[model samples]
Target: MSRHEALNPDDHRDLRIQERRDAALGDARMVCIVVPAEFRALQAEYPILFRLNETRDRFSALAMFGFENGENLYLADGRWDARYRPLAIDIQPFLIGGRPDEDGPKQIHVDVDSPRIATGDEGVRVFDKHGRPTPYLERVIEQIGELDHGFRESGDFFAALQRHELLEPFTLEVTLEDRSDNRLVGYHIIDEARLNSLSGTALAELQAAGHLEPIYMAMASLSQFSALIARRNRRAARG
Candidate 1:
């Protein structure tokens, strides 16, 4: 359970955050929501794809880290062994809060019940005795702000992908380390055939909209599935 509230210096003067990377820190996820801005960075580590958010009735781009729910192959020895951690994973126990004033800047809020919150002098302080945000908290503010802004722009990017008719449903069948048969469906990715079939003018429009690079990045990232399979095999062997 997460008890989230807008962080203010008034009541949260003693709020501190424990910087931990253990599995309990909640990084163990099969899919991390991502924006196009992080696509280039995410592709190097995880296979990027899109999945339907049934509740929201929208398509969200995601970096697939595992085949099963709550299964993250990048986790080991209480650490995440990946060169690039998606922004979605990095920003935990925090979310962009809506504002009463429509024109106001995004506000940052913390989940008080989150395991990451601590006040035993073992982690980063949210505010000092003088009630000023610490440098670490300042960085968090900046990162969360970036995520908030990027998420809005990402919505338009998804719409553009739809406009160009580039996304397609994909299914994968693979044998895991436990010798169990797995079939992953209900995901979407760039249709290479349709993408290649686009006219030059259409490609130019996509490029002009700043979505062309990320599309290629997502296509290239499918190869990382091989890396993920190897990781599963290694983890299974050790067990």
Candidate 2:
């Protein structure tokens, strides 16, 4: 007689969206890390690195990160298989060129990649096209370029938030797939604020530094939100 164990199909089958809800939760947080203008020196010490432009005023570096899942994914270089490269040097006046801004980072057409594990800053992860967490850091650096320019132009680092919706209302969205069939099995949307509260320590550290901290939830009160809109309108009218 062949000895075969009777299996509970549901136990081994693909997870339903609700089945993973208890174990899988959506979460997101923002941090402001200071990178010195002379950041190239630190590259050799880490798994990543960069080379500077001729003027020495600017440099480029890689942005991959080690994630909880152990999968290190960078922006999918659709044209090239290369996963890690100096984002600044590789992407430039043509690929990421944007309308010039005196204060903000130059706007560029950088594709958003899925999040993955990061290398530094234990527990710090980045969001990608799908809102899933990953260790990818290049996207953040790209944002930094934009933020630097935006702040210089509009005098507010969060101007991108008001200009773009995809970047705002930050949240974590989980999408699970069956490896065999590549079918989506589960999904979840984690509120950024909920993640912020849970990551009080990380948020506190960012605040301690003089960085334009990101508030997961834009307005703590409705009146405040309204006031901001009124101010924006008034400023636009003056201009």
RMSD in order of candidates: 2.0, 23.7
Model 2 lDDT on a 0 to 1 scale = 0.28
Off by over 4 Å in 2: 1-85, 89-96, 99-101, 104-106, 111-239
Candidate 1 regions exceeding 4 Å error are 99-103
Give, for candidate 1, the lowest lDDT window spanning 10 residues.
Answer: 95-104
C-alpha lDDT of all candidate models, in order: 0.84, 0.28
Model 1 residue 33 CA deviation (Å) reads: 0.5
Best by TM-score: 1
lDDT of 1 by residue, 35-83 (tens): 8888888889999989978896778888887888888999877778899
Query: Any idea how many clashes model 1 has?
Result: 0
Q: Write the per-residue lDDT of candidate 2 for residues 23-64, one digit (tens) a residue.
A: 112111111111222123222221222223347423222222
* Candidate No. with top lDDT: 1
84: Cα error in model 2, Å: 9.6
